[model samples]
Target: MYKSQIKIISVIIIALFGFILFSQDLEANSMPSLDYSIELQHDGSGIVTEKRQMHLTEGTEVYIVFDQLEGSEITDVFVSDYDEPFTYQENWDINASREAKTGKYSLIPTDEGYEISWGIGEYGDHEYTVRYTISGMVRQLKDGQSMLWRLFQGRNNLPPKKFSITVTGPKYFDPELTKIWGFGYDGEIYLEDGQLVSWSNQPLTGRNHITVYMQFLDQPFQPTLSWDQTLAEQNHQALENNSYQNEDDTTDIVAVILLCSFLGIGVLIVILASIYTAKRNKAIRAANPLITGIKRTEMNEGKVYREIPYSEGNILDVAYLLQEHGKGDMEAYFNAFLLKWLKEGYIVQLNTNEANGDKLKLTVQLLDSNTPELEQQFFDILLSAADRYGVVDTSDVTRWAEKNYDKITELKASLPYESKRTLIDRGYLYNEDVYFLGNFRAEVTKSSYQGEDLYNRLIQFENYLNELLSLDRVNLQQQNINEDIIIWASLYNLVEPFVEKFQEVEPAYFVTHHFNYSNIYLLSLYSSGFSSGYDQAVTSHQTSMGSGGTTSFGGGGGSFGGGGGGVR
Candidate 1:
């Protein structure tokens, strides 16, 4: 009888242990994603909305921290799961019952900043959308307007699997006069349709926070709080080691003009300028016509380059060059490679029953075409995600990427290296070792051409493609479209616009070209879907413990917010 009882107890213990292991495994595999949107008001306030889709294994609540918020007020805090609004609790209890904590939130003030906390309802998966208004978000500097803010805090265990931030400035915001820079992570931040959009190229982990600095040269705001320093001075000090400086520095230009004026040499300066302008025009006129034949506009001068820089550049080469210049990212590389393969007959997109307006999910089937040496690994990864029928879909790609996050990250990190090596071999780039006072040695990569002519040519190529979109149907049809151009368009995140333009001008273009899509919408869907899947996969199952590549002190210095919080 004793033996039988012990056997039953051991079986029960074994089953419980198995269950515990299973739960831990599930939680380990699942991850959360956050999407944040901030709209800046003319009054210098910002309305921030955080949409967090979380997978919770434990903890009854989660919270966000808003620290370093002196002179700033956090108000109108609201949290909901789209089903019902959470009631505001003046005093939030951390140890409350799941039933008691459900549909409740609290705003607690800390010595540093405010803590916005909400109940997690029951565990598993939950979508929590939190909204709050931050007063004094955009400050008025003595010389210009400035906004230095942190979107996410580093060292928070709850690192988002996939995250994106969309910051919409005032309607009258001018991209030309406003200079923006991003810090604290490896990502690309740029102005899109007058809005500043930023996203993580790789998964955010460890000390990788999100912070932005926007300097408005036109002084567009009338905020109550004022800073003593000029925005330019503050920007210079903040962006000491950061790389994403997109604006041209006019300090030297202004100084040179002032000195020439003070010296009463205006006529001499004008003659020199004219002579230089004449030479520039002569060089431009002597250049061969681009394949697109898009005429360069004045706006393209300095801001946009209208020609391909290198003679034997491919999509990967261009993607690498743009990335080195902070104008491209992993998303560009991912989309470009996928589309390039499809165009080269290595894969075929099959329409599925799924449809969303003009967009449709595409099932990709591997073709018998020989894959290029540079593309073989990526192709093999896609094949690994394929079903027994030798087909892969968007979902499959996402799943495979999630399961093989390290592989994808390593592959992406290798692309730039490979492209750079190719360029170096071609004499476009070379390494030069520099010594600091004849003691320490550092090898700095140098471009062969003066004033980054190769990079400018890429910009020109991009400008040409952009100009093509605005052309009339007749003019558009007169231009030739090729696989390389399409791949570069994907890198530029203009595939959708290009597809729309093609569809509007000549729907027959897709049928005639190597695009292999009967419906132009399907091509657009695949491009978007592939990008989305790749992002979702890379972000999943990534821990907050990263390799410590934090640049928090660089551009994000003196930024408001950036305290850390998680499930507690």
Candidate 2:
């Protein structure tokens, strides 16, 4: 009886093992893949050629879905299996038997989206190339142009084992200016050979889709579809909790040391305190004049003005002075506003936790304060950039600036004129005749007698701030250096150097004083980050593909296109 039972068990094990091997063989043979090449025309139309390697058994047809087109339409669809191309059937019977539907395709328009269906054509393993043209694939945004598309849906019944997408536009995609991001599947996307290419790394299973978002600084195609709003900000926000967020590579060495230390707890506390001091000193050293890349105005030492130029100490007036005479760029204008806001309690900087890895991170809160009557609009714009919690961060500012580019540009263009108007009202500016071509002339706004005197005073004040970098602690103390003077120095791009000098003299200046050295540093960092990072972040797009790390086998929200197909 025991021998008979053993023989039966052996037979059952062999059968199960053979079945497992057979299933693996079947899966290996049946695995499918897709490659998409999209060529975008000058008028934003797209010619998409999908090369699919699929294994078919007794199935009658295969199909692809397109939805959320936003008035876009698909046309000129052709399907081939490297043999005779398939014929278009006016009314494709999806329920037809495999033999009846051979060498035929059709476009079925549903209320939700369109399905492009094609026959199997006696396939075991077949390479099918399906071509289609989509009108208005790219859209004109309020600030720029963008293309947001989902090549396929996550809920695809037979998701491809692998997929590749290559997109080419009317113009070469400049790597520095063109932004591309992929969502919904584990893959890599990059600009190469004047085009954008993306591919999947893993075989997609339950709810794995492919969505792509692309933007161009210089429009590569003239878009026909128009959306009267920017898509970048919302797209960026969608990627915040995704893998695209900046990764923290630093390990907690201190924690490891504490865990392994045989020393007393007091020693650990002392070590922590020393680390704190070293970090503070490091931040101060980082504030060195040479490290602050902003160029300062060079002035004659003898003409250094020790007094403030404008009694009111308006940042706008200082901005005007810098724009008219000093080496101030758009950054300087932003810095001037930031510093002024920081000093007058219009904006308050919050302390960030270093242990949380947000060291030197800048965050500000917009307070309810009455702004300057002349600059009320500017303040309102600033407020518009803040979040629901009244907090302002780099991302918030970047998004606001990108979306309101025209509004901000118009406001900034009016600054010089507004400052001049204020000066004229105060009897410091006048319209004067200027010569052109030695025959014609135009009356231009210029400094009057009083304005010229005030300009000299402003130059002298800037010179004084420049000299502070060279002065010793004792000599620096002699100069009337107040918050107002420091804030005004930002106009001349001297605030960074001033911070470095102050750090050198009084190491505890930030600690003991109500003054915000951090505000200056943070705003400067914000400005630099904005110029580069903002363009990259706020102008890009995203979809909910993964949850911060692992693959999200759910749905892809915030993307176009829906549904997917398999051999039916």
What are the per-residue Cα lDDT tens digits for candidate 2 across 378-460? 55645677666666677666656655545655766777777767887887776655443333334455556776677677777
**What lDDT is obtained when candidate 1 is compared to the true structure?**
0.66
User: Where is model 2 more than 4 Å wrong at Cα?
Assistant: 1-31, 237-556
Q: Model 1, 1-568: lDDT tens per residue?
A: 2335445655675566546544554234234678889999888899999888888777777888887786888999999996579999998887887778888999998888789989878777788899999998898887788888877765644777678788887774565556566777766666677787777767665446677777777877778676778875666555553432332333345445545543544454456556555654454344421211223223245465444455475556554567754555655655666777666666666655554543333445654555445566667666787887777666666656555656777877877888878778877777765443234344556567632566667767777888888899899888877756777776677766887788778778877677744433444544455456556443222211111112232356667766467787
Residue 36 CA displacement from its true place in model 2, Å:
0.4
Error of 2 at 230 (Å): 0.7
For each candidate, give its TM-score against the true structure. 0.43, 0.48
Error of 2 at 378 (Å): 32
Score candidate 2 by TM-score against the native: 0.48
Please list all clashing residue pairs in model 1, or write none if there are none.
206-544, 305-459, 305-460, 306-460, 307-460
Task: Give candidate 1 regions above 4 Å deviation.
Answer: 1-31, 241-554
